[model samples]
Target: MTSTSGARSHTSPWELYDGLTALVPRGVTVTTCVVSRWALVETDAGGAGLSSVPDDGRDDPHGPQDVVGQDLADVAALVRSWDRRLAAIGLASINAWCNTQERLEAHAGDVIDWDASAFERSGELVQGRRVAVVGRFRHLDQLASRCDLTVLERRPQGRDLPDAAAEFVLPEVDHAFITSMTLANKTLPRLLELSGGARTTLVGPSTPLAPEAFAGRVDEISGSLVYDAPWCRRALMQGQGMASMRGALTLFNLRVPA
Candidate 1:
C-alpha cells in the first residue's frame, strides 16, 4: 500500500531528523524490545518497529541496561548516537511510534500503485537506464539483468563499490535505490546531495516511513509493515531477519510526485 496523500513538511535534508522526531508522540513507552542482529521495539500502544542492527563489531547494545519500559522519546533521541546499534534501536523506536499514528488506510494500494517489492515492478522503469543501488538488496539479480547497474556497499563484496564511489557514480545515474541504513549511519543527507538529479528511493525495513522527513530528498519511500508485532519481536529474539519474515511483513512503497 502507498499514498502521495502524505502530508508534507521540511524540505531540507538537515531538518529530516527534526521531522522524524516530531512523528513520535510524547508519553508512549516501549513495552517490549529486542536488540539482536535486528532491533525490534513494540510500544505500549501496540506499534512495532524493526531495524537492521549494524554489525560494526559492537559486542552488545545497552549492555543489559534494558530498553523496554523506557519513555520512547529517550530512545528516539539515540537515533543520533555515534554507537550504531543505539542508532538502529532509536530508528526502530521512531518507526514504532509513527506506526501508531500514521493513517495507512488513506495510503492503501487502491489509491496508489505500490508493489509488494519495489524491485518486483521495476523492469519497465529501470531497463536500459543507468541504475545505482545502495546496500546490495538480497534479490538484486533481478535488477542486475535489467539495467546498467552499480551497487555501493559499505562492506564491499564481489564487484561492489564502496560508498566512496557515490561521489563519482550517483551524479551520472538515471535512478538510485538507496538503503535506509544511510539514516542510521548518518550518511543519508549526504547521499541525497550526491544523488544529484537522479530519481532516489529510500528503501529497507529501517526506513522511518514519514514522507515529510524525506520530502525533498527522495522520490519514493519503500518500507515494511509488521503485521504481528509480537511475532516479529519473537523472530528478532531468535536472531532472525527479513528472510524469516515471510508471513509477518507487507512491503510497500509511497511515491512522492515531482
Candidate 2:
C-alpha cells in the first residue's frame, strides 16, 4: 500500500459540489445524491435530471420510498441533447447498491464499444487488445475472461494506495475505465498516472475536474453523472464498518479527465 498524509474528513453534498464547481471541465457532469433522489450538475454545460431504479416494494429503513431505477433512457436523452459530443457519462451507482458490472456484461453488445458477449459469456480473448479496469469487486473473473484484457484493481485507502500501481508498466492499452468512488479515497490521480498512454476513461462520480492532475495521463473518464442519497450515505455510515457503503455504491459509474 502507498501512504498519504492527511486525516479523513466527512463531506456534505454542498461541500463536494462547491469544491467541484471551482474546477468544472468541458463536456462533463457531476452527479451527487440528495435525499432519496439523485441530482445532476453539468459543470461545463447546463442541464439537470433524476434517475430511476427497480423497486422491490420493500420499505426502506430510512422511510417509505418509490424505488426508481437507473434512468438509462434519460441518460441517453441527455447525451443526445448534448449533441452527442458528451463522449461519456460518469455514474456512481455502485455506491448506490447497483450491480452495474453484471448489467454491463448482460448488455455488453449494446453498451460496450466492443463485442463484450465473447468476453462475458465465454471469457474469450479479444485478441491484440489491452484493457484497464479500476476498482475490484465480484466481476473481476468475468472481466479477466478476455485473454487479451489485463485487469488492474484500484483500491485507495485514506492513507495508503493499492500496490496495483506497478501494473501500469505495460506499454499501453486500447481502453481504460475508473470508478468515481476513488474520490472518497483521493486516488484518482494516481490511477490516471498508471493508465499512461492508454485511451483511458475514468468511471466514477468521485472523479474531479482538476485536469492538471491527469493531463498527459489518461484519455477519458466515465461514471454516473449523479451521486447517491444522504439516506444511503447515512446507512453506510451507520454500518458496522465501511462494508455497507462499499456495497451500496458499487452499482454505478462516473468519469473525469484522466
Maximum-TM-score candidate: 1
What is the lDDT, from 0 to 100, of the residue 122 in candidate 2?
Answer: 25
**Compared with the true structure, what per-residue lDDT tens digits does model 1 show for residues 1-258?**
122222233356547777788778788888987888788888888788887777663444446247888999888877777677888888889888764324455555422344367777777789899999988788889888999999999898999999799999987888889988788778887777777578777888887767756666678888877777777877777878778765787676777544
How close to the true structure is residue 142 of candidate 1, measured as C-alpha lDDT? 87
**Candidate 2 local lDDT, 1-258, one digit each (tens):** 111211112233233323333332233433433223222222212222222221122223454222133333233222211111111222222222222243335433333332121124323333345665555434555555554555444444442235365364333555555554443333445554555545555543344323333333444333332233343446533533223333333222222222
- Candidates' lDDT values, in order? 0.76, 0.35
Query: Candidate 1 has which clashing residue pairs, if any?
Result: none
Candidate 2, residue 242: how far the Cα is off, in Å: 9.6
Could you tell me which 10 consecutive residues in candidate 1 have the lowest summed lDDT? 1-10
Which 10-residue window of candidate 2 scores lowest in summed lDDT? 79-88
